[model samples]
Target: MERKQHGTGEVVFNAINYTVFILYTLICVFPFYYLFINTISSNELTGLGLITFYPKGIHLSNYIQVLKLKGLPRAALVSLARTVIGTAATVFASAFLGYLFTKKEMWGRKFWYRFVVITMYFNAGILPWFITMMNLGLTNNFLAYILPYIVQPFYIILIKTYVESIPQSLQESAQLDGAGYFTIFFRIVFPLITPILATVAVFSAVNQWNSFTDTLFLMTDSKYYTLQFVLYRYLNEATALASIIKSSQGPVNMNLQNMQTPTSVRMTVSMIVVTPILLVYPYFQRYFVKGIMIGAVKG
Candidate 1:
């Protein structure tokens, strides 16, 4: 009787746990699902707020139409380029600096490490930062996207702590074998720090992909606009976007049911901005917890 009771309790506990997690998952996923359904459903109905839960009158025209918008393709390319380049640069800087900070032989090692870490505590304000960028000739330049993000204090700290967890004996062995610091770092240290580096890459990539504020301040040229900034413009200028869509399609194909509405444009653009990060996140998620725990907690 007691065994049966214990089994029953265990089943009940598992059931409650699963139920709670399922509800939480639904809460987290519902907004994305809602947006996706609205974008695919009849734009007319979606505009009226009738399409909820399951998609109705499903069509992919929203995505097709959104892709057709002016400057979207160019903005997408710019975003992709920055994400790839920025993530690579940030990871390299973090890893190299992390390794360098660990070496006691480097002059002013402690001072420099603390100097980098202290930047996290404060910002110099936007006007000063903009002036600095302007002075450096980075305003409206592609380097504006990549340069300032390279030496992130938080990422550097994570990498530095992670590197400290590595065995110094390994580096010493490489030194004794006549391998220089660069050789040891590239061949040994870089490979060994994959997990933490991957974590930092994900961070940098997300920052690069989602950033638009820098563009708002630094870029006066439309050619340099990023996808996120374009989305921002689209949202803020919905009427203009609608007019553009109509002008593109012309009067002949202007069917009321199939026509893209401002709501649809907003939701669709939001999904476009969010989709890349969602797709890329799963690839790096497995390393996220492991890297954060080891890098954060170990040291």
Candidate 2:
């Protein structure tokens, strides 16, 4: 290979570009690093909010204490269920409906599609929505998380734009082969839209995973609590009330005083909440970039 030489101007420009990118990367990653060091640091130091760059005291006790918190396991399970079920439901519903919109035989497609878009931009206030959820029996129910988000108009629009990019002849030929819309969609369309599907699935899963307000408002029962709500309550409420919150449904003797400092505990919870998405992101990173690029140019 030939050694390439850059002019003075090009060398200076490349140096500036690398410097900017390095700074941007550190800006994005430092908070997470701080959280990690603080979480594993001595509980007392963490509580005092003294941990800044590196851990002063390091041990696994903070994590152990957090894991021992009552009702935490159940709340985690609920969050997992919500993320998986909600993402699947949202992706399938949006893709199928979006595919239907691409069909010529669908009646009043424009108006119907517009109706979904309208709902995305407008909502009856919280009180009315709460009353509606009550009527639908979603209050205090696990279904509340999965049901309300099963059909997302923004995802549908993105999927619709994606579906429109596929050649019509392929679908027409499949129809001529006596295949129905469902078969064509599942066999011909779904496979080609993996990038967009991954993109939407990530979005749906993240939304469901981080959701806490829904639980706070709709879930009065302790059994219906989700992990995010548990974290939120811990961060905002006093530790003295932990025993009360943990056993709100029934009588139980418990002690939470020995739990790590609030900051350490908060860091632990942040790690717990964020770890799943971090683990899953690499698998979708390729699809995410591709989807955004294609959707931006075509959709």
Model 2 regions more than 4 Å off: 1-8, 241-259
lDDT of 2 at 58: 70
**lDDT over C-alpha atoms for residue 199 of model 2:** 93
lDDT of 1 by residue, 1-299 (tens): 46544588898999999999999999999999999999899888988999988988888878988899989999999999999999999999989998999899999999999999889998899899989999999988999999999999989888888888888899999999999999999999889889999999999999999999999999999999999999999999877787788678889988776687789889999999999999999899999887877856543
Q: lDDT for model 1, on a 0 to 1 scale?
A: 0.91
TM-score of each: 0.93, 0.89
Query: Which residue pairs in model 2 clash with each other?
Result: 42-57
Positional deviation of residue 181's Cα in model 2 after best superposition, in angstroms? 0.6
What are the per-residue Cα lDDT tens digits for candidate 2 across 115-166?
9999988999999989999999999899999899988999999898888888
lDDT of 2 at 160: 88
- Tell how far residue 61 is off in model 1, in angstroms: 1.8
